[model samples]
Target: MMEELEKLMEEAASLAGIYSQEWTNRNPSDPGMTILENLSALHLVQRESAAQVTEHARISLLKLAGFVPLEPENARLAVELAQKGPFSFPRHQKFYVNNVCFETEEEVRAMQGRLLGVYVKGQDEFREIKELKEGVPMNARPFGSEPLTGDEVYFLFDELPCGRKVGVQLYAEVKTSGTRNPFSEEEPVDFARMRWSCLTSCGYEDIVCQDETHGFLQSGKIILWIDTDRLVKEQVGARKGYMLCCRIVETAYDRAPELVAVHGPLFSLIQRDTQSFSMSFGGREDIRIQPVFPEENFFFVYVREQGCGDYIRYAEHAGPGSEEVQGRYYEKRLMEDGRLQICFLDRQRRYLPAEEENAVIVICCNREMMLHREMGVLGGWENQKFDLPPGGCADAKVLCIGVRYAKAEGSTCCTFFRPGTEKRDGVFYTYEEDSGQICIHDAGPYTGCNIFLSDYALSVWDAGNIRFGNVLTSAGGNAGVRVRNPVRGRKGRAKESFQDIRKRFLQDMMQPVLAVTEKDYKELALQTPGLCIRKVSAYFEEKRNQICVAVMAGTEAAFPRLPLLYRRQIERYLDKRKILTAKVSIKDPTYIRVDVYVTVSVIDREKWDIKKVRQEIAEELDDRRNEREIGQIISFDSLSGRIRACPGTGHILELKTIPAGVPGRFIRPGTDIPIPPDAACYPGDIVIREE
Candidate 1:
C-alpha cells in the first residue's frame, strides 16, 4: 500500500514541475513571475536533473531579472544568484564563468548598478560634494526620500544613478536633504558649513580659510624681484672674492646719477669733448699700476722718484760749466816682454821710481767722471754757455747728443742729456743745460775687461753693432774672408794639389784610337806630319799581351809611347776579334811584328777563309801600330804545323819556322804550349808542337 502512495506523490510533483516551466516560458512581460517560476522548477528537482536543464533554467531566471548572461553555460547560475541579492556566495557555489556562454558575476554586478541607474561621483566633484567621503555611495536614498539618519551612512552602489550629472545632482540632494527640519524648518543648513567640514577633514584648512593672509598662501601665484648687487656678492663669495673691475662711462650726467655721484671719488673723470678717460694712480715707483683708458685718451704723465735727491745733486754737479777738474795722467815705460820699467811723473810733477817695476800705475782723476772721448764734452754744450778747448779731440770728430725733456707749462726743459759715441781719443762728457752743471765723463774707453761690464755692455749694445765696432772679436775667421783661391799656381805651388794625369793621358791617347778606323790609319799618318816610328815591343808578359808601341819626333807619331789608358782601347778592339792575347812587338830600325796563336776556331768556320780573316785582323792590328814599313807576324805556322815568324835584316827578310813534333819548337823550354781544339786557348798562347 505504501509503495503505491509514493508512486502517486512522485507523479504529482513531476506534473507541478512541468507546469512551472510552461508558465515561465509563457510570461514574457512579467519578469518577476518568470523568475519565480524558474526558481520553483529548480527547487522541485534537487540534484537529479541533467546539467543542461539546470543551466537553461538559471539563464532564464537571470535574463528575467535583467542580468545579462554572456557565458550562459558557466555564468548563468552565478548571474541569477548575483541578481538575487547583495550577499556574496561561497567559493564552491561561485562558478567559473570563463568557459560558459554567459557573462561573469563581475559583469552581472556591473549591470546591477547600470540597470538600477546608479552613478559614481569622480574626485573633481568630490570637493564640492559635502556629504560624500572616500568609499561612500553618492546616492543613499531615493529621490525626495527621507533625510539621512546617522553620522555615518552605509549605501549599496545600486542605490545611485549611473550618469555623472545625475550622480552629482543626487549627491547634492542627499547632502542637503536633512537641512529641512522634520518639526519646524529653519533655513537650510549653510552649504558653506558642510564644505568647511569636508575641507578641514581633508587637511585643507588653508583652502577653507576666509582670512586674506590665508588666501594669499593658497592663491598659487608668485612675484619675484632680483637683488643684483646681492647676487653679485654671492657669486663673488662662491668664487673666493676675485672680481673683474668694470668700466663704465656716463654720456649724460642727468641720466646716470651713479656715475655722477661717484665721479672723482671711486673713479676719476676728465671733462672733455671726447668720450674717454685715463686712469693714473699709485706712486711712480710702483710698477704694478696700469693705465686704463679708451683709445682716444691721449695723455702723458711725468713719473718722479722719491729718493733721487743724491742723483739730482750729482747730476747738477756733473753738468756743463761747473769746473775744469784736472785729470790724473802718467806715462810708464813698458818692455817688449810686458814688463813695466818706470813711472815718468805723478800729478805732483815729481819722478816716482818704481818700487815694483811691473806694478800697474793707475791714474784716477779728482772729478768723479772724466772726459775720455771728445764727443762727451761737445755733446753736453748744445745750448749751455760753456767754453770748450779749441784744440780738443771733440773738434776733430763729430758728436751726437741724446736729450730727454720734461714739459714745463707750455715750454720744455731738458731733464737729462748725454753724449752718444766716444771721440777717437776716447773721452766722454755730459751736462745738464738747464742747470749749467758739468761732468767729466770717464777718460778711459769702455774696455769690457771685467766680466760684469762685458755682460752689461752686451745687454745695452746689439750683437751687430758690437761686431761692427770690433768690440767683440769673432772666435773664427769671417765667412766672407777669402781663405781659398780658385786660380791654379797663382798664390802657391800647384803641385801640392792632386794632378789628374790619368784623365789627361786618356784624353790625349785613347780618344784618337777610339775615333779612327783601321782603313784610316794611312790617312791619319799622313795628316800627322813628320811621323817617325822609333821602337815597338809586344808587352805579352808585362802587360798580359798588350803592345808597347814607341814612335819618335812628333806628338802625333808617339803612338808606341801612348799611355796605358790608350793601350786599353787597343786591347778592347783586339778582344772583339777574339784575338785577346795578340801582342804587337817592334824592334828598332822600323820593323814590327805581331805575335799570336791562331785558334782552331778561326779555321773551323764555314766562312773560314783564313786569308780574308787574317787580312781583316791584320788591318785592325796595323791601324793601331806605329808607322813602320816592315811588318812581320810570329804566328802558328799552318803549312809546317809549327810556330814561326819572319826575321828582318836592313832591307831583306827571312822566314823562321819552328818544326812540328819538337819540344820547345816556338816557345822556350818549360813554357806552356797551347793545346789545339781547346776553347780556353786564347790567341797569344805559346804553341810548341807536341812530341
Candidate 2:
C-alpha cells in the first residue's frame, strides 16, 4: 500500500508540473503534497474495493458452479438407564453431565411388559424357543436355519407398554466384534439391514424405530414403535398376545443369526441441551437474542411473538409481502463473533407485536432438532445463496428443505419450494451438502417475497461423544432411575468445515465413479452398503471374459459363507459402476480349514501356562486369517515360527500340518500350504502335547 501510494503521488505531481509551472512545491512540508498523499490513499482504497470479492459473492460463485457448503453432524452415544424396578421414560428426556445434556432418542418402557414367548414362523410350523431348547442348548435361531425373505421371528409380549412402543433387544451367544481398517479416514458404513413389522388389525405394518444389531448379523438391539391401539392379538400355534414380527426384508449375513434371548424397552440417547426463555418484542423489526450456550452447539431456535398463540416461523428469505401464507416469520443473522440475532419483519411486512406480552424463545443446543426454521428475503440475484445460522456446519443433516413464498401481503397465494436447478416459475433451491448453503434460483413470480426454510435438522457435529459415567444424574429424576454410559461413546465426528468441503470437491472431480479395472471392482464390492467386508478379490478369467469377485465376510463370522442376499447386494453395487462390456459376478470365496498338531518340551514348567499357550496358538491362527490377503500363501515355516515365538517355548519335538477332514495327509514339515485363488483359509483345530 505504501509503495502504491508513493507511485500514485509521484504520477500526480508530474502531471501537475506539465499543467502549471507555478506549482513547484512538492516537498513534505507543502500543503499541496499532503493533498496529493490523501488522494493517493483514496485511490488505493477504491482499487482494493473494486478487486476484492465479498463472502456472499464467493458463496454465490460457488453455488453457480454447483458447490454449496455442508452442515455439522451431532455425535451419537448409546446410553443405558438403570432403575431398581420397572420404569418408563419418554423420548427427549434429558440427563445432564457437567452442564452438558444428553437426551433419549426413543421412548423406553423398561421391564414393564414381560416377554411371554419367542417363536420362529416356518412354512407350516411355528417353533417355540422353549420347545426348541428342550433338546438343544439355549442358543436359538429365531429366523430358522436359512432365513428367507418372508421368514419372520415372532416376539410375543404379555402387554403392550404405554405409547405402544417396544424396544426389542436381541442378545446373541456369539457377539460380533467388527475390526475396522486403522488407516481408513472414511466413516464406517453399516452392513446390516432388517425390516421390523408389528401385527396390526390391517396386517403386519412396518414399524422400526432403530436397529443396532446390524440386521441381526450381531447381538444388539432393535426398537419398534408399535401402534397398540390398532394392533391385533393373534394366536401363534398355542400362545397369543401383541406379537411383534421381525421380517427378513434384505440381508447380507454370511449365515443365520443366532440369539440367546430377546429383551426390550431400550433406547439410544444423544447429547444436547434444551432451554426455553422469554424476550420482549414491542413491535420491533429486529430483535437479537444471545443464548447462554456456545452458538456452535446451537441446534434449534424458535420465537413466539407477543399475543401470538403460535410460535413465529423462520424463513431463509422474506421481502416486502410474505406473511399470510408463511405466518408470523422471523429471520436470523449470525454475527462475526458467533452470536445469533433474531431479525423480525418491518411494519411494511405486517409484523405487529403486542406491547403487554413477552415473546417466548426456545432453543435446543446440540443433537438433532427437526423442523429448524429460518426466514430470509430473496434479493432476486441470480444464484443467490443463504447460509444456515451459526450451528449449521458442513455436515448438518438436511432431511427435508423447502422454501415458503407469499407474493402479496396477507395474500394466501404461496407455493412450496422444490429441490433442483430446473428453470421453473416456482421457488427452487439446491442444498450444497459440503458447503452448508442453500442456493435459490428461477423465482420468476415469487421474487421479493418471503423465502422460508420450513423444515430442517441440526446436530452438534462431534460434541456428543461423552465419556462413561459422564451423566451422573437425570435432569428430572422422578422415576429414581440412575443413568450412566456403560461403554464409551463412539461414532461422533467433528463438523466438516467449508475449507474441507472445497478440498474434497476438487479431489472428487478427479476421483473415478465407475469401476473399470479389477481393483476397482474389488473396491466397489468392499464398499457394499450395510456390510463390513474383510477382503474382496476380483480376477478376470481369460477364456470366459468374466470377472469373478470373491468376497470374504469380515471375521465376525465363524464360518463365513456369503449368503444369497449378500452376493446379490455386491453384484448390484458393482453392476451400476462397471462398464457394460465387463461381465461381473459376485461369489463367496471357498473356505479351507487347516489343522495343526505340535509336540514340544517346556523350558520352565513353573513359568509355562499350558492352557494359555494353547489359547495363544489358536488366536495366532485367527489373527493370521484376519491379516492375510487374497491368494496369500501360508508358510509352514512361518506357522512354526509363530508357535515357537510363544512365551516359555522350548525345543519342538515334532510339528505337522494336516488338511482338516483329510486323515493321514499331512504337509511335509517345511512346505508351505498353497491357497487357491478364490479360497479363504482359517485354522480348523489344533492339538498340543508334551514330548
Candidate 3:
C-alpha cells in the first residue's frame, strides 16, 4: 500500500512540475503550484492507494504530500471513529491535537472524530465534526451536522512570502449538544476545544494558543492579520525605521507627478525661501512625496526623529535676490558630518550663526518627512536669508593683477597677489632672436589701478612671469623704484660714453618701473588674491593675419617656426596696460637661423592713419638703420610704391608706395609725407615716395 501511495504521490508531483512550467511560460511573473492543486492531487493519491496501502503507508503517503499526521490525542479519536463510525461529543467537550493534516473531506472527518472522542446514534451520530478540508476548516455547523474543520479555515497566510504580511478571517460554527436547562443545566460547560495545535504543515510557525479559553469563545475561527513591518522592526531595531522612512520618501518623490510639472515654479519658490528653506516645492507638498526629486535625487536631507534629536542638512543656492534686490544673499550650509550650523546676517552680510545657539542644526540636513513641517515647509528652517557675501558670486566683477616670469627654456610660473585675483606671472620665455628681450625698467607710481583679465586673455601670460606691483606697493600706494649698476663699470672714453648712454636709458626706464611696498604686501595677503595666472606652453600652432605661429608645443608640428606663443603672451601683457603693438621674433632651434620676424601693431585705427603711419614708421627705421653699420638694404618698387628694404646692416625698412600717374613711382629718403586730404592708408602698411 505504501508503495502504491508513493507511486501516486510521485505522479502528482511530476504533474505539478509540468503545470508550473506551463504557467511560467504563460506568465513569468507568477508561476507556481497553488494550494488547491496540491490538495486535489493529494486526494487523488489517497483514493487510489487506500486499498493497497497500510496505515503506516497511508500516513507516509500523506506526509509525502506535505501533510503532518494527527497527534496521539487526535489519533486515538480517529481510531475510535474508524471502529464505531462518525460520533458526536457532549456539549463543552474539547481536546488538543498535534501534527494534524487534512487534504480531503474524508481526511477532515477522520481527523475531526479523532480529536473530539464522542459518538452519537443514527443521523445525529456526527456532532460538531470540525470538517478539515484542504488544510482548513469548512462547514463548521451544529452537532450532528458537518463539523467545522481545517478545510473551512483556509490558511490564507501561507500564500504570502516568508516575511510578508497578510490578513486572515476565521469562521466557527458553535452549537450546544443538549437543550438548555436554565439553572438545572450543569455549570455552563464550554463544549468547544479551548486549545488548538498550530499546524506547521501549512508553512507557518507553530502558534499554540495558550489562551485557548478565549479562542474557543471566539469560535475556532480567529482572524490573524500579519505584516512584516513589526517583524522587521523586532529583528533589527530603530535603524530600520530610518531606512523605511527613506524608502517612503523615495516612493513619494517617484510617484508625485504634479510637483514635476511645476518644477520652475517650485525652484523659484525655493530660491525665494533661501534662508531657512533650502528647497521649496512651490506651494504644494506634492514634491515631498516624490522619491526622484527629493529623497532619491537630492543627496542630503534634514532628518529629525521624534524623541531622539538627530537631523541631516545640505547646501542650497546662495546668490542675489531677483533683479529687484541688490544686496548679497546667503544660504545655510548642510554638511554630511554631524554638525548643526546656521548661516545668518550680521550687519547685512552673510555669516554662520554660532553652534551653541542652535543644537538642532543637523536637523536641517535631513531630506526626510521627519524634517518637514505640517505647514508644508521643506528643508532647513533654521538657516536665515541675508544680503550677499562680501566677495560676491563667482561671476562677480573682479580685478586681477600680478607679475609673470618666463624662463630661457620656455617654461613659466605664476602666483596670486591677493584674493579675488588670478595668477599672471612665471611664464616660459623662448627667445626668437639672439638678443634678449627688453624688460621694463620703470612704470612710475602705482595708482589705485586694479588689473583684470578674461580666462582666454590669461592663457597668453601663463607662459611667462608678468609682475604687477611688488611686495611694498601691491595693495594700495605708489610703485617703488630700485636701480642696479651697469653690467660692467665705466672704462675707456668710448666705454664711459656707452656707460653714460646706458645709465640715461636705464634712468628713463626706471621712471616706469613699479615698486613694491611692505604695506601693499600685507594688505594683499589679507584681501583675496588678485587675478589668477597659469603657466602654459605653446602646444600647437595658430593662425593670426594669415601667419602661422607656433602657439603650442607638441609633437604635431604645425604653423611657422616663430615662437608665436611667447609673442602672444607679451601682447596680452601689454594689452592689459592698454599698450597695443610690440616687436616679436623667433630664433631657430640652434639660435643660428632667424625663423621669422614679427611686428605686433597695436593701433586703435580710429586714432591713426595707415599711410601716414607707415611713413612715420619708415623714418624711425631709417634712423635706427643709420646707427648700425652692418645693416643691408634691399628695395622693391611697385605701383603702390610700397618699398621693402633689408639693410645688410641688420635692419629691415618697409615703405608704403603712394599711387601716381606712372606705374613705378619714385621713392624719396628723409621726406615727411603729409597726410593726404583724404587719408586712405591702412595701419601696418609701408608708404614711400620717389628718391
Candidate 4:
C-alpha cells in the first residue's frame, strides 16, 4: 500500500514538473504545486471500495472479551492411541488432516477401538469387534419418594468431564412379594408412568425426559454441561440448592414405593425454599480444597445428637446465643494451610465447641454446581511410592511422565530445570509462538510405567495452576507430570489481539461502561469462554426481579445445548453485579426446526463426490448465520450459491429450495434465511436432493 502511494506521488510530481516548465512557475507557493501536494495527501488518506471492505473485514468484532479464534493446529505424529486388545496395522483409528494420515487418541477403560483382543500369543490374531457404545455409570444414587416435593442431594464430582454425554442411571425399587412385600424375584419398576426431574443449568433445561423400563435399573444418557468457573463461584439455582438435583413423583402409585439407588439427571426436580437433608456432607470444617479440586469447597449444615445445631459459615437457622444475641451467626477464617475454617457461636457467643466429633452434616453446596476439573495434586498426594501431586502432573491434557514446575520468585526467565539434574533442562523464551505443539508418546520410565516423550524435551510450563514449588517424584527427581499423548492443544484464547485493540477503542466511542441491560448481557454471554452465541434474548421479569434469558449457540440443524458449566458462568456473572432487585434465570430457547432442501448441477461428475458436495453446501449455509438479522428465513439463492461452490456443481439445472411455500415470500432462489429470536440449525437439519 505504501509503495503504491509513493508511486502515485512520483507520478503527481512528474506531472507538476511538466506543468511548471510550461507555466514558468516552479516555486513551492505555486497554486499547481499546492494542488498536487493536497491531492497526494487525499489519495494517501482515502481508501477505494475493495480496500474499504478489506479494512472493515479485518476489524474483527468477534474477538472481544478475550475471544481468540481457534485455528486447526497440527500435532507431530507419535504413537497412536490404541484400544486395549490386538493392535494391528491399517488401524481404523486413522484420520487425515492436510492429506496426512494420523492416528486418533482415546481415553482409557474404553471398549470402542480399532481392534479386539485375545490373551494367548500362540494363535494371536487381531479381529474387529462390535462397538460397545454402552456407558458405565461413574456415579449412582438412591432416593425415597418421601421427599416427593423435589428432594436434593450434593456429592463431589471432582472428575466429571464437562460437555460429554454421561450415563444417568435412575431406578425406583418396586416392591415384590409373596405377601409381606418380600422380593422373591426381580420386577421392573415402570418409570414410564413416573415423573422425575433434576435441576440442570443453562441449555440443559431443554432435555426432554425419555421414559425407560425398569430392568435392573432405569437409566438414560445426556450431555452434561458444567460451567467450570461459575459452578465454583455461585450457587446452582435460586435457593442456593444442590449443584445437581433430582425429583421424582409416582403417578404410577398413589402410595410411595420402595426407592432404589439409581443415578440420573431429572428436570422439574426443583426444591422448594428449604435446606437439604438427604445429601450428607463430606467436607470437613476446614474448607481445604485440593489443588486440582479447589473448586470443591462446600457449605454444609452440621447437627449433633446433643443439640448442637452449628452450621458451616452460614447459619441461617441457628438459635440465639448465650447473651441473647439474635439471628444465627457463624465465623470463617483462613488457616495457614489455606483451608477455610468454620465455627458457630456457642452459648457464650464464642465460636465453636472446643472439640468436634460425631457431626451429622448435610451438604447443600452448588458448583455453578463443581464445573472445573484439572490435573493437580491437591495439598497432599495420598501415600503411594510417588509423592507427586496432581500439580506434579506434567501435561494436564494427557497422562505423561515429567513433573510439574513453577519459576522461582522474581524470575523473568522460564527455566525447565529437571530435578536432580546438573543442568537446567532448558529455558523457553517464546510461549506464544511455541507451546501446545509439544507432545509425548512413549519413553523409558524408572517406575516401569510406560511414558510418552515428546521432542519438547522440557521448556515452557503453564504456571496458571502451579503454586508453591516444583512437584517432586517419589524418587525425588523432577516433579513434573508428563502425558502419554497430547489431550489438548491451544485453548481458544479469551483475550483480544493487538490489532483488535483499535477496534475496541473505536467501539468504546459508541458504548462505554458495562451496565445491567440486554445489550451488556448479550455481549457478556458471547464473551464467555467455551461459548458461541448466535443470539441472546434477555427478558426482564420486573415483578420477580429476574432476567429470563434464551440463547442460540449457532445455526445448525438442531440447537447445540449449552453446557451447565457455561450456563453457570453467565448466571454468576449476572448475579455478581446485577441490581439488588434483579435475579437472573437462564432458559433454553424454543427451537423452530426448519429443514433446507437444495438442488445442484454436477460440474465435474467424475471428480465430484455428490454426497460430500451436498455436505459442503449444508455447512456453508449454516456458516452464513447472523443472529442479529432477526426474522430471517431460509434463502433459496443462498443455498444455490453454496451448491455452486461445490467441486462438482455445474450451473443450476433446476433449483428447488423447499419449504418455499411458507407464508412469507421472503426467500428467493437462495439469498438469506430469516429466523426468529434464539433459534438455531444443526448439521442434519439440511436436506439435499440433486437433479
Identify the leading candidate in terms of TM-score.
Answer: 2
- How do all models score by TM-score? 0.12, 0.48, 0.14, 0.27
Cα RMSD for candidates in order? 66.7, 14.3, 52.5, 23.9
| TM-score between candidate 4 and the true structure | 0.27
Estimate, for each residue in 274-332, the C-alpha lDDT of model 3 and write its tens digit. Answer: 00112222211221211111122222222222232222222343565422332222244
lDDT of 1 by residue, 1-691 (tens): 3454446445544565577665433333667545555555555454335534654475465456444322101101101112222222111111211211111112111111211112222342211222233334343322112212121111122221122212111111112211111211121111111111111122212112121111111111111111112211112111222111111111111010100000000000011111111122333122121111112112222222232211010011123332342222223343553322222223442222222221221211111112221222233323432323222112111122222322334322212223534555443554332233334454343322110000000010011111100111101111111111111110111111112333344354543432123322322222221122222222223544433332221123323343332334333333333233445432222322333333332223354344543443344334243232222332323322221221110111122223233235545422333321101111221232211
**Once model 1 is optimally superposed onto the true structure by TM-score, how far is the C-alpha of residue 604 displaced, in angstroms?**
6.2
**Candidate 2 lDDT, tens digit per residue, 444-521?**
666776665433444455665666545446544232356655445555666455566567778776555689887788
List the global CA lDDT of all models.
Answer: 0.24, 0.59, 0.24, 0.36
Candidate 1 accuracy as lDDT: 0.24
Q: Tell me the lDDT of model 3 at 4.
A: 59
Q: How well does candidate 1 match the true structure in TM-score terms? A: 0.12
In the range 205-311, model 4's lDDT, one tens digit per residue, is: 32234433232132222223333323331232222322332334332222233322222221111001111111223323443321111123345433432333322
lDDT of 3: 0.24
Instruction: Give candidate 1's error at residue 382 in angstroms.
Output: 41
Model 1 CA deviation exceeding 4 Å by range: 1-590, 593-606, 609-612, 616-691
